[model samples]
Target: MNNQDFPERTCLICKDKKDKKDLFRLVKTGEDKYAFDEKQKEQSRGYYICKSHECLKRLSKHKKIKVDTDDLIKMLNLLKKGEKDYLNILRAMKNSQTLSFGMNMVLEEIEHTHFLVLAEDISEKNERKLLLRAKELNITYVYCGNKQQLGEIFGKDEVSVIGVKNKQIARGLIN
Candidate 1:
């Protein structure tokens, strides 16, 4: 299927239509209970919201949702758990041996890499080189966390860049 084949949903706060996969979903599980559906597969009444802080803030103040402040905050926290989710994905890729790290290793294996994850604190020279190579190869890249944070995922003291080898995992990370 192509991009146009994906279903669209409207954000409750902004009332703007967007691809379902591009929005965050919140499902009503009970009369007054709501849960964040990170995977967007919950079997309940689901509400779509734009994946932006502005929409989140607007939703929190929405009077029609009937949710108390505390419950709304808890549900919002669940949506903000993306950092943990990203780390878990990295760990899974590491265990599956589908990840390459370090500047030299990633550059050497660039041909096989599906995606690039660079540290926010990466040196200017290294970032320029990796970005240039990625652009030439048409490989998608993203910046996340700092060197120390990314390095911890690979049991190293520091890592400025990581290359994901699995196409499906890379697509998922980008989305």
Candidate 2:
């Protein structure tokens, strides 16, 4: 019933704790060696990983990993390069794009807390995730048709994507 009720161990990756019985421990015993320790008998520097592949990727790249007690975390393993690149792309995407809402919504649509721009008849090739994210946000979405027209209304060079960020994000969006 309680987290502390179990015999727990902390995950070296997320620094969260789980019952030690559930975590899978990986130990680094030598320069290029790794092993899974079921009994945790090995004294070598070890880490615990959760079952998800994404979390496993996070574990492999996390900086505090120690192959030996004194060894500085020199670099992540080579297989994580592509995953690291993917994270970099996500960082850039967040900075480059954002959602906007109709100014009229401030007066006319108090009933609707959020919105999704449907881009009524715009090209779907590039703005796909923007649409999906709108649905995921469960906002009031509209398909105004014609990216060019939408861009004109928003005074942007191109427009097929937009979202009405919640109050928490509104301040950040404004500044």
Candidate 3:
């Protein structure tokens, strides 16, 4: 949606008006209980905070409101978990003889691909083709992280595509 169509929300900490979707939301569900509304679909009195961690910390300290720091930590942990899991999958691939790297190499054996991981920085044309082929073959594909990170896992300066030939490890990465 355009900027005009988006609902504007003022951050309680930063006092800056921003699109509702661009800020974090806290919904008051019970007497003094507040829950972080990531989906912004909660039905209750809600307050907006900037997406910044600093703003979240400030809001958490507000009087009359009880916010668990663990909730914030948990959210961060969940994000970190994805990267960690992907890295672990790459590590396992490094040791296996079935792992394939490079767009050309992956596309060569796309028919038997178990899991396809593509870096976000990959070219649009290549990304679209690989994703489409993966879909046609019913292979699980994940578009995640940056080229540098993916490359680091493969001991390269940058990598755009990786194919896991091991079904068990591929399933683990997809799950």
Candidate 4:
């Protein structure tokens, strides 16, 4: 038998035949344990699903089980807090007179920046420039959310980058 004679697996969701290697293998490890075989080395009874998220959703719905993405969920929750904390920091900065926005203002005060937040939708050129400034000034920085979300926090049409002058909030945002 040659590779042409090798058995193909069917996607549980789409009901399409594909080479076993081309599909995601989910193996039943124990009586109730089922995991996607990312490494493709598990020795157990297995089923295949397509790589698309829709396929995963269908499988999850059919099986009545939620796919585990704990790390992603935790990160998303942190991003949510990061957004609210950013708004609070901005408000507090108004009282302390230490907040700055806009590219030039942030670039000018880069040295005083305790933490920097860059919008993911910002232009590559702007991202490169701001990141370089952050690195040169040794300011702690992170990329979170998108331009629209950042804009809502700062009350603008859109915001590319925001620099935090408050050290405490900056620390919280980073961690």
Best of the candidates, lDDT: 1
* Candidate 2: clashing residue pairs, number: 7
Q: Rank all candidate structures by their lDDT, best first, as comma-separated numbers.
A: 1, 3, 4, 2
Q: Global lDDT of each model?
A: 0.80, 0.48, 0.75, 0.68
Segments of candidate 3 deviating more than 4 angstroms: 1-77
Lowest lDDT sum, 10 consecutive residues, model 3, at 74-83
List model 3 lDDT by residue over 38-108, tens digit each: 77677776687665545556666777666677767754454456667777768766967778888888899
Clashing pairs in 4: none
True lDDT of residue 110, candidate 3: 80
Give the candidate number with the greatest TM-score: 3
Give the alpha carbon lDDT tens digit for every residue of 39-154 in model 2. 67887765665433344556555555434322222222322343344333323334433444343332233233354444445455544645454455554443433455455555
lDDT of 4 at 168: 78
Listed per model in order, the count of residue pairs whose N, CA or C atoms clash below 3 Å is 0, 7, 0, 0
Candidate 4 local distance difference test against the native: 0.68
Q: What is candidate 4's CA lDDT for residue 110?
A: 85
Models 1 onward score TM values of 0.56, 0.28, 0.58, 0.52
RMSD of each: 6.9, 15.0, 10.1, 12.6
Q: Return the candidate ranking by TM-score, descending.
A: 3, 1, 4, 2
Model 1 misplaced regions, further than 4 Å: 1-80
